[model samples]
Target chain A: MRKKPALWGLHASPPGLLKYVLAALPFLVVVLVYLIASDLRHDVNHADKLLPGFGQMLDSLKDLALVPDQRTGKILLLADTLASLKRLLIGVVLASVFGLFLGVNMGLLPGFRALQLSFVTFFSMIPPLAILPILFISFGVGELAKIVLIFIGVFPVIARDIYLASTQVPREQVVKALTLGATQLGVIYRVVLPQILPRLLDTVRLALGPAWLFLIASEAIAATNGLGYRIFLVRRYLAMDIILPYVLWITFIGFSMDWLLRRYMRWRYPWYERGGN
Target chain B: MTDTLASKYQLVIQDVHKSYGEKKVLEDIDLTVRSGEFCTVVGPSGCGKSTLLRLILGQEDVSSGFIYIDGKPVGLPSTDRGIVYQRYSLFPHLSVLDNVILGQTLRIAPWSARSKRKAFVDEAMVYLERMRLAEHSHKLPSELSGGMQQRVAIAQALIAKPKILMMDEPFGALDPETREEMQIFILELWDASRFTVFFVTHDLEEALFLGSRIFVLSQFYTDQRGNGQQIRRGAKIVADHHLPKTPLSAETKRAPHFLDLMESIRRDGFNPAHLQHVDDFNLRHPDSFRTLSPGEGDSQSDRMPQLWDKSQ
Candidate 1:
């Protein structure tokens, strides 16, 4: 029950810190493999075979050997991973903004709740990938369509959960607000929405998973960029090293977003942790 | 003629009648709650005590009659009146301060309002301090205990500086000790503000402890035509006579007259009218009249309409 400390410009507890370190384990292993391969390839500098660097690196690691292969390729893979991470981080930031706006509005307003729940539920029920073709057809091979798909996939679920949580707030409280002479907007913003924001964050944490999945799916189909497309491109040549870095990058981004969101939830809504009775 | 100098009265209900379809709940009910008086309306469950309160607060409409606040007929809820329900009707999302300030935000002056956030916050803090809910200012409604939450609800209502306060069984759910404490706290609060209170309760002791004048609603009866109607709805003063005009002693708790007044309301006005059938009257001996509570007298007088001859 100890509180998590705010550290390193990230709101994370010891466990969250541990989780980040653990997530980096796979990349560390990749780096170790690259280092060993370079050490072996360096020993065979005059070799005429393409596989010498990899094969020698594999054999040298078995024999405790040192060699240098082309180091530039590994650096390129790291750069690609960083670029994908940046894109996803940007994507998540945009999604969070859109989700919070849509969710808070739908959750806090009765008329909006009634108007939106049906359509939002309808869209959410359809497997996000099922609509990929429609997205590809309409906004083919564009990042706009992928971002829009992510926005649609994330916003509705978050909005619906937040709307229900806010609306389901006890009738007595709403009456209490009204009786106190609160204007309609005051009741919603001051009285109603604050109570719902925590629950909305919870929904966002859940929706982000599907949001990432959809973003990856859409990128794999249409986008010429992003980890999803990059990973798919590497698969044709069985370039596991290239694909592995992208996989590690995507996982890192997802985990970081989840952690960041949860951390923010804990800070902004401490009552949420106590279950608020 | 008995007009209060500062405020004539908190509420004046003139010939109020409430009907749901063919069923009549309150008929020709006239009541005037004077400022600074704590008025309790006691009745059996479902006798429209809550409906009466709702009508006074302008939450529900009266089929016929005028509900006036300080001589002004009110058609909608206004900040001048505050209400507490038996159940804790607190907004669970907002902190105690936010809930208290929710209503006042609308009335705050625009110039100082935007800039002087501290003033508004300080005002809310003052009310929270008064309610002893200062520590819970940042806690959500559900995080507090039931009693604390109820206090917050009361605070939320009072923060608007309402002229009249209405309560429907506000302490009906508390244990005896908590209930007594709440009653005393409310009385103290009322003494400070001296706002008129329209309190409803089924507990007779609660009625006597809090109410300056207790009005008991008789049980409703259905006519042969299957119409559910209030019994003697016009007769709010059936036992207003039992209420003593002189100041009561601090030891009024042990006084016989106080007990007698309560017994009368219960035996005659409440139990017989609400529970016992009219045909069962012959089971009692003639000498039972001496032992009967004052409430029984009203019923007895009503039953023997022929024997109870009147000039009218």
Candidate 2:
């Protein structure tokens, strides 16, 4: 049967140029709502830190970013960004390596799967925030504690997701590799590893949200510098101006990281996408 | 070596039986194939033809007897055997050439080592040329047609130079024209290389066209195992016929003797009531034999064992 694209319906193919504006519609509406709320709140009180106006927000960001903090002798925004980024990078790198190793082994070997699957499943259930006091008391409110918290929070989920992806690799492919002269280890690293790399990146992207959550929680409870620490420190004065910009900056960084990772997956593995994974 | 019977056979399955708990999937499978023989097996769906292929491939255990390849007992699947499924056997992350060269690379130096990689690439290129896939070598398997992909799979398997190439419906996913073209393509490659093959397909006609010897596996046959009751058994070789290895031509399909043999095989294996006695089964190949030992529960009606010679 011959079928053509329809103008509008479930099978409709919209004009390409209209797609861009349509995607931006909801985002534009959210900004407008916040702007109106900020203006109305400012009108009621001449000085309102709860929902600062656009000008006040901009000035607060400039002060935090360009000028040095009087107490800390550091550009608060730059220093916070660096400190937060360092922890995030180390934590995520460690989690990815550990998760990939654990998950792949669990998938390929029956004994390893039986040994570790339950333990990993149970480990992922422990809430990072619930153990915050224990971590603080043990690691003593240092960078180690914050980094470890993020690691514990993100690693298990990454491992579990990677395990699932590894298992989902078609059994036929493994058999085919064996038939083609691959040993057991050869199948894992040579045949299976390349197939799972993209899925690992996708899992990391999904795990980023919780990584940030754990980072912020740890910093809020105990830290000298970080975006999360700065946000909490300003909360005593209700400096919404500083808090809002910091929150926005954090979101922008997370979004960019996710996007870059996704693009990397696509670029490195063109055939994987074609495999319709 | 010449004194032993098993040495004459390229693959020997002796008293091979398989079952899952109470359900029997294959039983009394004793078939031996000679070296360089293109043996095609056709059977009705669910007759466990694929299971038999897996047993020979060492992907699954037979549950009873031993399978010897090149006079060596087979175990878990290894580089000694090569297989091509209907699809998805090729690594998607690798290019067509990479897929074909995987055997050589994994057998050679570490993946990072490239000192003699050029030799492996050159060997792969020759197989690619034979399969008419040389130009598409650098492209991904996803970029090729179904027939092209199967060709690449064949080249991939053939490059390794395994003892036997086992293909399970290798061209089943292709269109009619592509399927015929691939059948002929494989025949040409086999005629040149003389690699032993164990091809499984449900299409009876394709079996006649491609095989130097055709094996019909079916569950429709009856035997003397039951005491006036039906014995629940699985597929076995109901018939085996030797075909001449003529170079590819469409006219052989239209020949009267070929048509008659095809029809008889269809009747012998496809019809439930036409089951011949176990001894009288039409195993016409010179290499064919029934190594029935001990209480297989035989009766007086079983055919007498003989050294089969068409002249006799």
Best candidate according to lDDT: 2
Q: What would the per-residue lDDT of candidate 2 be over residues B243-263, giving only the tens digit for each residue? A: 986658867888888899889
lDDT of 1 by residue, A1-277 (tens): 8666644446664567777987898989987886677667657775523233445434533321133326443344445445455545566557666656666667667677688768778877877677778877887666667776776677667666666666566655555566677666666666677777777667767777787787778767766556677777767866654455456556777788789988998777766642342
lDDT of each: 0.65, 0.85
TM-score for model 1?
0.70
Q: Which residues of candidate 1, in runs, are more than 4 Å off?
A: A1-117, A240-249, A273-277, B1-9, B14-29, B58-66, B73-76, B86-99, B106-114, B121-129, B132-145, B218-254, B268-312
For candidate 1, lDDT tens digit of each residue in B1-312? 214311555677665678888776875565566677778888777678788888887777988766778877775666777888877477554577766776676555435556766777898898889888898798887677767777887887877777778887889888887887787788778777777788889888778767777877654322222323444432222333223433433355557877877776686456634433322322131111111222233355445544432211
**Interface RMSD score of each model:** 2.8, 1.3
Candidate 2 residue-wise lDDT, A159-255, digit = tens: 9988988898877788888888788998888889878888888889999999999999989998989999999999999999889899999999999
Instruction: Give, for candidate 2 chain A, the lowest lDDT window spanning 10 residues.
Output: A1-10
